[model samples]
Target: MPPATATTPAPPTAGATDRPGATGAPGRAVQVTWAVATIALVAVGTVRAAGWLFALCLVAAAVTGTLAVTGGRSPLGMLVAATLPPAATVRALSWAVRGLRDTRPAGAGIGVGRILKSLAISAGLLTLFGLLFSSADAVFADLLTGLLPDISPDGVVGWLLRLALIGGGLLGAAYLVSRPPDLEGLRPGPARPAHRLEWTLPLVLLDTLFAAFVLVQLTVFFGGAGHVLRTAGLTYAEYARGGFWQLLAVTALTLLVIAVAARRAPKTTRADRLLVRALLGTLAALSLVVVASALYRMQVYADAYGATRLRLFVTTVELWLGLLFVLVGVAVVRLRAAWLPRLVVGTAVLALLGLALVNPDRLIAERNVDRYLETGRLDVSYLSGLSADAVPALTRLPEPMRVCALGQIAAELPRDGLWGTNLGRERARRDLAAIPTTTGVTDCPGTRRW
Candidate 1:
């Protein structure tokens, strides 16, 4: 999933770099100062506004810390939702620390190993940062629902995620309570299958149930052969003609394939194994491609329109990905075919390709600026080069250029929005109008007109 592009605090990190004494001391001191300041402010706030507000923040922080410390699996999500501003500040700071994590080791100069370690650590920090933001966002409860009038907010899917987290935690706790004695009791042994039918059976049953849902949905949605399966006076024909039916049909097919494979017995033949792997691989790849394509489309829509497009539920593609994951999970449990593993590999490849096609690098660069436009970091340098080579072309740009090429041109305009984006924008508007629907709109792709 695309990481939240919100202005978060620095990425998370251990911040254990061994830097010069001077720099390290000052940096550490600054951090300490900030921490002290935060604590003091909170304390003062508590003392002055010691009523429900201070008590609330304290209670909120305590609950969040408790949840995190307890390994609540869902993270301190509720706490984050309650304090988004503070969370954003802290998260941004965390990311900043991660970016500066490899500044130096005063005693030991940079080395190959250090370089690699730094890279790994930086990536890990960023990964953690993303997770933190995602978890925080997930806890929205209903704060945003009030802001967005179009969305119903807090749908069935969100309920599922919450339930899963809570159930998993409970299951983990139960397993730990019933776990067999540890290494001290073992004279000698290698790893054994981690689970038996007790675990496997339930998951298998769940797969079966999901597969059944898919099948029923398919019949209802597809109305294949125009066969109407109606209930309660609502004809399947009426429902199946819409987009929902097509999606359900596709999803149902995927589920049936998984369910069938799961119910089948495993074979020992090499050829059989290979075939199974290939089929699974292809299925997985296509699924991933669909997901990537969907995400890219959402990104485009969001940029062209506004983030409000995804204010409530995520894009359709994301939901499809979830369904895809469930389908694969079913397959993994039932299908021992050699082809199954390849499905995941294919999904990875196809997803990458789809994403590349859907979201070209140039578009992404532009969108990045659009997303951060509020911050005044809308980098319009994308047009700088075009200006050089296409200088003449820019000057002669058509009228409609302003609307189509707004991304690149707007940034160049003064704060007062005067002068309008270089001539290209003006040209865009003009060209869009004069150019018929048959002709594709064009622009100076270069950053400058050399």
Candidate 2:
């Protein structure tokens, strides 16, 4: 044999981390990856001129990223995990901080320091070149100007606040990844004995109240705003606006009451489950009618005042509530099923995604224009306030209205030089360019030309 040569022991296999019930703490690589992805999304949302929908995407991405970092497996559970409150996030963070007690060095002998130093050097050189290029191009310079931090007191304060919020949020997310939320409470469990009077008394009172309200809604729903206003000594707008928010409040309160009662409902016997089911089912059904009434009131209002992003979004929320009650009915029937909460949460997420896809600003413009076509009255002032996504729809309006709409939009649209990066702004600019002339509207201030 060759003269004795020392042989180093083989490093512990990477497989060691995957052994049964691994603590599931996010590795350094995972943490860095999640941080990069989240930062990229925020950068895109800022620099590319994305709309509210894109903002929502950022939130969803952040939530999903946090859940993944924590090692959550179920898609539905991930959805639920996204809703962890700040307090819960903090608690998890504390739990993760405790693990630091095992402070033995990780990645020992991997040349990690050398790798990090190389990465820093590469990044520094790249950034220096990027800054030089930004200085050389006027458009790129403008973008950099917009992106760079401002030195004013208000700007500094706002920036600091934003920085704090973002840092806190990331810390919370990292904590969540290490320890996902406990969701056992959402699952159906062994039936506990019920106190029938405690559950039913309030429910009976609530059911009666809701039933009476539904009776009143029949008149408003069929009799129309005119009849309700005339009978109640109020204007149509007053009746509609006043009742819309109030009904929403009522619906919210009723839902809360139902939730509390259901949580506390005795499920010891078949009869108890049936009774619980019957009361909750009845309340949910009645709530649907109330939701319909609220929707009708909103339609009446929108018809008179023109659609707005707020109104459109509110309509969507009511629709979601109606669907939720429908789901509740399903749950009432399958009382023993543990999947109802997950189903409800999944449905809500889908509903929100669908709303985002609808593009509320564009939809608002379309509805308003259609309303104008039918009634020959457009709220130019309101249409002017909408985002660039509304530009295409507004341009579709006929002649003088179209010219005026374009002028209003041009005034409000951001002239940020990165037009090519944003579909909405690019399309708006293109459409504005195509306008033959703003010739005829010289009388209307700021209504002259593209």
Please name the candidate that would achieve the greatest TM-score relative to the true structure: 2
- What do the candidate models score in CA lDDT, each in turn? 0.39, 0.68
Q: How well is each residue in 1-450 modelled by candidate 2, as lDDT tens digits? A: 779989999887774545221223534443354445545455444433336656765775565455445433333444455666465556755664555443446665434345556889998997798789897998987777676666579869977997877667766766654554543223345456447897799899989999999999997778877888888899657867888899888878877786667767887789888898899999999999999999999998888878877788788878888887887777666774344654554565566567655667778889989987888777776777677778878888887777777786776666543322566777778888887435567543221111
lDDT of 1 at 306: 35
Please report how far candidate 2 places residue 64 from its true position, in Å: 4.8
Best-performing candidate as measured by lDDT:
2
259-321 per-residue lDDT for model 1 (tens digits) = 455444233566544544545444554544444433443444454333321211244336545
Q: After superposition, how far is residue 448 of candidate 1 from its true place, in Å?
A: 43
Per-prediction backbone clash count? 49, 2
Candidate 2: where are CA atoms >4 Å away?
Answer: 1-50, 56-119, 128-172, 178-194, 411-420, 436-450
Over 4 Å off, model 1: 1-195, 218-222, 225-229, 235-428, 433-450
